[model samples]
Target chain A: MTYCLGIVNCFGIVIAADSRTNAGVDYISAYKKLFDFSVPGERVLLICSSGNLSMTQGVITELRRDIQNHEEVNLHNLSSMYDIARYIGHKSRQIQDRDRQWLERDNIDFQCNFLLGGQVKGEEPQLYLIYPQGNFIQATKETPFLQIGETKYGKPILDRTITYDTPLEAVAKCALLSIDSTMKSNISVGPPINLVMYKADSLVVRHTLELRLGDPYLAKMRKLWEDFVRQAFEAMPNIEWQRETEASVEDILID
Target chain B: MTYCLGIVNCFGIVIAADSRTNAGVDYISAYKKLFDFSVPGERVLLICSSGNLSMTQGVITELRRDIQNHEEVNLHNLSSMYDIARYIGHKSRQIQDRDRQWLERDNIDFQCNFLLGGQVKGEEPQLYLIYPQGNFIQATKETPFLQIGETKYGKPILDRTITYDTPLEAVAKCALLSIDSTMKSNISVGPPINLVMYKADSLVVRHTLELRLGDPYLAKMRKLWEDFVRQAFEAMPNIEWQRETEASVEDILID
Candidate 1:
């Protein structure tokens, strides 16, 4: 399992991915899932991949090849963020095609998904959740973020707190905190985390942090969250029952 | 969809369930998902269910019939909470037997699950997570809470805070808050929650709250959680980049 979350707002973009992967309880590994393409002073785009290792690795390799060859569709040369998403989706589909037989015969799905986002020189920053089917959708104010992989576990926080007005740093924190939640619930998604924050129009990979275990800040945040939760519990309203509707064991029994 | 969560501790037990059902995004309705069989001064048992409304409702209806018709086993006469869990599991399998054909033909799953707990006379408090196969597992200090149905969204806080020493009111508050997270994220669970909190040895349902929409305390807690989130974000550690390697993007491309 993996957690890849990105929030793009008026300020910029925040993207994070967890490194844990597992093939059941016995086999676990750490593989960085966030890849950034930043031509310093030129462009900074982020790609977070999830799903089957083989399929996503294949897609990433293809994406890298395009960069090495300076292909017209490479991340550095894309006309818009949306175009980048389409390209990613296309690459994912291509990988699936190569494994089509195995996918059907062995019930193996190369279920690869990628989230691509960033800004070009002239347009506003954008984010897209590129699907395995070679289609994608951009983030809008109504839904200002995208999450992939083991997404359901961390979605509630994003749903409640993410918006276009959210600051870039706050978005990054939210992404990591969301990942933390998943880590505790699912062993397959333990940290070290890859977090990238891009400032709008910066044309540089701004603040990128690698949070490994024992990172003091992450530790403190976890503790504070625990403390806050305790406080939240104390603040809740007390139960006000109209009356105790008591029923006897005999009264609840049948004839 | 539905969300039901319970916390068992030395202080007692807290169980909360949302009453929402949906056959898709458009066809949505509300139905009670919480059932209780309490013998006021002697024993108390609460069952919170989530999944196919038909399956869950069928289980509850069957239990009611068992009580009125003096079926082979009934919750009211159960000597232990563990026995109650087995009884519910048996009734669950029975319902599945009768409805399995309709579900299989339509390609729909009768995925009824339950979170049942309470005190039965002499035993200390207990909690169980009942699966569809008529098997259940009890909660322990290592994992003091159990949730069913749209549960992931509401699980992070429970993972961090719940334990055997947790107070009855605190656990109750956590249950409601967890339910709130689910209600906000999924449309399948919403509004007017049904809550029950049991005090050990009292064997009586002492605390119960039906949280309707627009409840002041609910609104306040939601806001406080949001504010804390915002605050927590600002406190995240700053990213530090050391003597940067001439760059890694090139290596990624070349490789």
Candidate 2:
């Protein structure tokens, strides 16, 4: 299992992913799931993957191979972020199709999902969640984030905090907190977490951070967030119940 | 869909459930999902249901019928909370079995999961999550809560806040926040929320609250929680990045 998320706002886009991969509990391994393709001044594309390891690796390898071989439509040559997303989805489907039959025969899943986020030289930074079936959806202003794999645990925070007007730094912090919450509840997702903040139309990755267990800053953030959460919870007003004689009234009536 | 949770602590137990049911987006309804069976000074049992509405209703109806007819092993006649849990599980399985064939023919699911929590005379307060397979597991000291249906969105808070020693009032508030978070992330799980707090050794419910969308207290709590969360995030230390030239030291090392 994996947890990868991408947030797009007016200022920029932030993409994050966990690095743990497991064929089984006993076969756990750490693999980098976040990959970046940059042309320095022209375009920059980031891809975060989750699902079958072989399929994701294969898709990434093929994507790199396509760039080297200068395929008709490679990430570097794409005109828009949407086209890059479509290309990644197409390549992902191609890789899965190559293995689907043998994998199905062995009762293994050949599905992989990807979060593609980046900016082309002339276009706005965009984020897309490409499904296992090679279809995709872009984030909108009202919903400025997309996530795949073990997503729910980290979602409430994003739903509450993220907006198109949110600053890039704050969005990055929220992404880390989101992954931290997911890691706390789910064992399959773990450190080191990969994070990147791309400024809108910068055409280059400016800030990136990888947080592993015991990393000082990660440790400080975790402790601080947990403490604040507990304190906040402790400070919330307790439900004031009605008097026993008046309990028959509506249940939410307070005092 | 539904969201129901039960928390057991040294002080007592708290059970909460949202009252939303949907056959489809077009066919949505509200039905009470929390029910209690109390014999005054003897025992108090609270049942929270999630999953197929038919199966849960059928199981509840059967349990009521058994009690009314004075069956040998009705809820009031059970020897322990575990027995009552097992009885509920048995009835759940019976109802599913009765509808399995027909439901399967129509490609419909005849499954329901339940949370049973209460205390019988001479027994300590307990909470059990009964699966659709008619098997159940009780909450433990390390993990003092059990949740069913649309559970993930609400789980991180419980993972962070709940414990066997948590005060009942705090646990109740935590349960409400859990449901509130779930409702924020999942449209299928909504209000009016039903909450009941049972004090240990009392064998009777002491406090219960039902909160709806426009309920003043609920609104206030929601606003307060959201505000506190944002404030907490703002108060957290930001990631201090290393200089680009020194980035090779380590992914998380600060300058």
Candidate 3:
């Protein structure tokens, strides 16, 4: 399993991914899941992928190949973030189609998903969640983030904290914390986290980080978050027990 | 979907459940999921259930009927908490077996799970998670909690705060927050939360709560938790970006 997410706010976009990949317990290994396909002054493209490793790696290779070959419709040639999302989704479908039957024979899941977030020179910075079925949905002001894989454990914080107007740096912090929460709760999602922070109109990737296992900063942040959570929990008001005649204790009941 | 959990620490055991059930989007309804089956002074048995409504309901009915009919092996007659867990599991298996074929014909899921927590007079306070296959695992001092149904979203907090030495009230608070997190992240798990707190030697449950939708305390706690979380996020140290000369931005990359 994997955990990857992208956040787009008024100031810019932040994308992050965990590095753990596993076909089974014994096959667990660390593999970078985030890729940069930026063209310096012309465009900024970031992708985070999850699911069948072979299929995702295949899609990424094809995407880079299209760019290196100067294909008519490649990530560098796409005019809009929407088209890039569709193109990635299309490549994903083709890869899955080629492997689905053999995988189905052994009852394996052959699907993968991607989070596409970046700016296309003349267009606004946008984020899209490309589905395994070759369809995609773009983030809007009301919903300014997209996540792929192992998403739920880290969602409550994002749901409560992120918004379109959130500052770029704060958004990046939230993204790291989100991945941190996931890594803490699930063994499948381990460290060597890759994070990128893009300034909305710069059209050039500036800040990127890779926090490997046992990194001092990661440990410090985890410790601080845990302390804050414990403090917060301690501050919650205790349950107000109803002051009534204790209900008959013999009333063993069912719903 | 449902979210039910049981946490047992040295102080006692805290059990909680959310009351949302749905067959389809149009059929969502509220129904209690927590039950009290304690026979004062002899034993304390609390059960929280999740899964196919019909199957769980059937299992509950059978358990109740066995007790009322003065069967040879009813819950009150069981000498140990382990036997009670097995009895409940047996009852669950029976119910599923009876309904499996009919449900499977239409591709419906007939499985359900239960979290049983409490103690018999001569034994220690314990908690067990009964699987759909009717096997159960007891919570140990090292891992003091068990959860079922829509569980992931609510798990991180429990992982961070729960332990054998935590206070009973604090454990109860953590259980509520866990369920609250799940409700916030999933529409399938919703309001009218039920909670019960059992002291180790006192077999009868002295404290219980039923927080209906829009309850003042629920709203207050949610607001406070959100505030604290935001504060915690703000307190988190900003990522320390590597100082390497910015990598060549033209390197459109793969892998």
Top model by DockQ, which number? 3
lDDT of 3 by residue, A198-233 (tens): 988777888899999999988898789888878877
Residue-level lDDT of model 2, residues B1-255, one tens digit each, is 899999998999999999999988888889999998877567889999999998899999999999999988899887998888888988998999998999999999888999999998899999999999999999989899999999999999899888888888888888998999999999988899999988888765768888887788888888988888888778878777442333332342221
What TM-score does chain A reach in every model?
A: 0.92, 0.93, 0.93
DockQ numbers for every candidate? Answer: 0.37, 0.38, 0.44
Candidate 1, residues A184-227, lDDT tens digits: the string is: 88778978898888878766675778889778877887887777
The window of 10 residues in a row where model 1 chain B has the poorest summed lDDT is: B246-255
| Candidate 1 Cα misplacement greater than 4 A, ranges | A237-255, B235-255
- lDDT per residue for candidate 3 within B97-168, as digits (tens), equals 998999999999999999999999878899999999999999999999999999999998898889899888
In candidate 1 the C-alpha lDDT for residue A9 amounts to: 89
Chain A TM-score of model 1 comes to 0.92
Q: Quality of candidate 1's docking, in CAPRI categories? A: acceptable
Per-residue lDDT tens digits for candidate 1, residues B1-255, read: 888888888888888888878888899877887888776777788888887778888888888888888866788777888889988998899898898998889999887899888888779999999999999999997888888888898998788878888887777777777888888888778877988887777777767778787887778878877777666566556445423345444342321
- The pairs that clash in candidate 2 are none
How many clashes show up per model? 0, 0, 0
Q: TM-score (chain B) for model 1? A: 0.91
- Which residue pairs in model 3 clash with each other? none
Q: Lowest summed-lDDT stretch of 10 residues in model 3 chain A?
A: A246-255
Which residue runs of candidate 2 sit more than 4 Å off their true CA positions? A242-255, B242-255
> Using TM-score as the measure, what is the rank order of every candidate, best first?
3, 2, 1
